[model samples]
Target: MTAHGRLPVVYFPEADERLSSWAARMAPFYAMTVSEFVAALGLKGHDVFDLEWRLSEGQGALIAARTGLSPEAVQAMTFRELGAAARMMIARKSRSACPHCPEDLHRKAAAQPWRFRCKVHGVEFRDATGETLSDRFGADCFKKLEGHAEAGAAHLDAWACGAGQGDLKAPEVLQVLTARHRRASPPNVDEQPRMSLKDRRDYQDFLTTPILRQALTVVVPEYDQAAPVLAKPVRPGLHALAQGSLLQCFALTVGIGRIIEDPVKWAISVMLVSDAEGQGRVRQAISPWPLSLKRRISARFWRAERDERARQSAEKAARQRQSHKYRLIQSHKYRYRIS
Candidate 1:
């Protein structure tokens, strides 16, 4: 086999391996950049990262032919079957370090928000701080919150993967959680003021107020003692967060889980409290909740209103009957006195 041919060596794709990961791993072995490597494999017109989601049959066939991998194996590395929302959750690079994985070869689980463990190893991933969730959160926190964290992770996995078919939509739920609270105390930290202008990223936290962090405390009182932090304060959705920021992801999902379990209370306690500072910006998130949820909440209030009206009408009719009885009693007494 020539240097460029089906030649030298081939690496089979790892289980739950990312398309980019498989390609990147092979690229260095061949003394080619990832682009150069795939180009040599009779591939063109699509970026390697893009192929992580959109690898076509033709593209898969080209890769499978050269690498001795089945087309199914090639396709498994990509997330083409996942919906757009789920696809958006993919991290560009592995967010956490897995003890079991080879250096720099990220598994698909590493890039996915719904998973916090190394898929192959079944152990937790070490995040940027070089700490597992237990290391970062400490013994007490790890014990108490781990189950909640797992619950939240399962909620997101189900919602993102379309397995739950529940009323909660993760993005809309996050919108409510992160919505600015009208009555929240100034989030201005003293240290925040002293930071210099050149280090602009630090200022990003201040630009967006401390909403999710504070809101999560309500979701899980266990988090009340723990100070909340955000990688980037302004987030449009969970997918928009810095992928490796597992701390934020954990808190966000935990809050989402609690909200999913009880949306009305979440809306009243978390979303409604946000500043009506400007008309109904906060209310907007509450308003567009999937119709089933909105109806459930509305139905509860509607029943209360109907019950109150019925009670009032009953009281009024009783009062009229009592008045008539009193008048008849008075007339009978008057007639008896006359006789």
Candidate 2:
């Protein structure tokens, strides 16, 4: 545990663009046919999605049922069509937070409330839900549908795992070693200005402080529980360095593979290693954004920047009205002499 005995939050494995690229190469098929593939891969029974049987299986059925097509009908749909449907279905289900309270109200309100207040909680807020919630037809119905989903299960993990429930780990902060130490650059030459020898020594000592080591243990349970296959017991500092180095090597391999543009191989590596959560931590420590979000975010940012510029222009006009030039014009009384 950390010095304060808290564990770090972990995220589920992200779908990789590299893997998606490989999957995209599959021959085209109808949406129903693609649904069959999904069913087959997940070993789902045809009745698993039956409306009559839906309640027993719970909210997952809500997603499947939204298609209004039976599992068999879904199986008959084309892959290309199913691809669009699948995206809509997923985006539909992701929880929408209340525009007011932190609680997710599940896309209940459509137009900005009279004062842009959330109808449910009557407060103004913005988050993933508020941003992604559709402004179109689904906005109202989806809110009710999502409530049904929530009634079935409180969180994604619970929904996925089913009836024998338990709490999922919440996000926490823990200390970790500053494994890599680079030489301080000359004062004027680099971003990290030079530090004195004593300072460096003091920093090194801080890294080894007992509280920090405890934090590492708290954060990374795997380190305490799963002994690395190292031959000897190394100092905590050395251990951190070794683990960090391996993660760096794996990242480099990923980079090299990307440079070569080998999607299949990249997919294989990602799928194979995704289960090793500790390694995921190491990867995140080095580079936070994975490929999928990176690709999608660029598109989001383009639109966001465009909208921001529009907003700024409007605001600028208002500001100009308050300026001296505008004031002078407003204050000036022009006498129109009829010639």
Candidate 3:
């Protein structure tokens, strides 16, 4: 189709490919850098940097002539023409590229913060260079987390969507639940303000063990089965493992409805006090904890809640001040307007 009578490489952009990524792929086939390829097409200046810009009909025709693709095909690859969902999921930074993606194809879905796995490969998505914790802990250890992968993904999606909608209560419950579980775990001897490499490796190993996995399993069982297991006498050095597992389960299972109902108070009361005292009747329950421990946990939750409320109040005040200033400025600007 070109005046030189040479056809460009017959390459079709992948569904997830960005305009720049597709150009990068085509550049290698033509023995040119991506910048050079853009230059060859007479797309000078900022046009080369405008990766998401829609191609005009003239621009599309010119690109088609040089690349041996239909003008429509080039337009299809442009991001500005993509549907709303696709646009929302587009990656602005190159770091969003999936390292494990075959042929180095950038994925649009990878742009979502909640998307941790490459669905096609069934592997956790690594950074742009394709590295993961498995490189250090070994593949076997990494596989432990994979067992809960489906639930974890769904939980993350729900949490992300809820957070995006300004619903903070669910996330707050998750934070409290995880903190309680983490407190039950044995203290790391190497714990410091900043963890050393050894401490990090040890922590990773700790999380991958069977004890934690068993605790997470408790979440899926019915209340009767779960209560008996939780009631078992705590063994020395195993408290942390049990707690960590329970925390992960709560994080992955607690829904917005439970959060709205303020179940944290009921759950904590039940876990720390026997049903006879906390519920006015004996029921399936964990052995009561020391009164002091119960008070400490309750106080921590209240303190966190108070701090969050203060933070929200401050933000609202700031917004109101800004709005008032904007109205004042607008009123002055309209002072001389004709009545």
Best by TM-score: 1
Q: Worst lDDT window (10 residues) for model 2?
A: 168-177
Candidate 2 deviant stretches above 4 angstroms: 1-290, 321-326, 333-339
Which digits, one per residue and each the tens of the lDDT, describe model 2 over residues 9-80? 211111211111111222123223423432433324543223111222333333235323344332322122
Q: Per-residue lDDT tens digits of candidate 1, residues 1-339?
A: 343357368888888888888888888887889998878777755689888788878888888888888999989998775677787687788877887878778777777765667878888877776777777668777667666667667777776677765777777777766665444443445324455676556666564554433344455554444443334233645643444267667667667777877887666555423444521555576676877777776666556557767989999999999999999999999999999
Q: Local error of candidate 2 at 229, Å?
A: 48
Q: Write the per-residue lDDT of candidate 3 for residues 222-302, one digit (tens) a residue.
A: 321222223321222212222322222222333222323434444443333222232222111211433554455467656
Model 2, global lDDT: 0.29
In candidate 3, stretches whose alpha carbon ends up further than 4 angstroms from where it belongs are 1-7, 47-49, 53-104, 111-113, 128-339
RMSD values for the candidates in order, in angstroms, are 11.6, 25.2, 24.9
Backbone clashes per model, in order? Answer: 4, 17, 2
Residue 108, candidate 1: Cα error in Å is 0.5
- lDDT pick, better of 1 and 2: 1
TM-score of every candidate relative to the true structure: 0.73, 0.19, 0.39
Model 1 residue 155 distance off true place after TM-score fit, in angstroms: 3.3
lDDT of 2 at 68: 36
Q: Which candidate model has the greater lDDT, 2 or 3?
A: 3
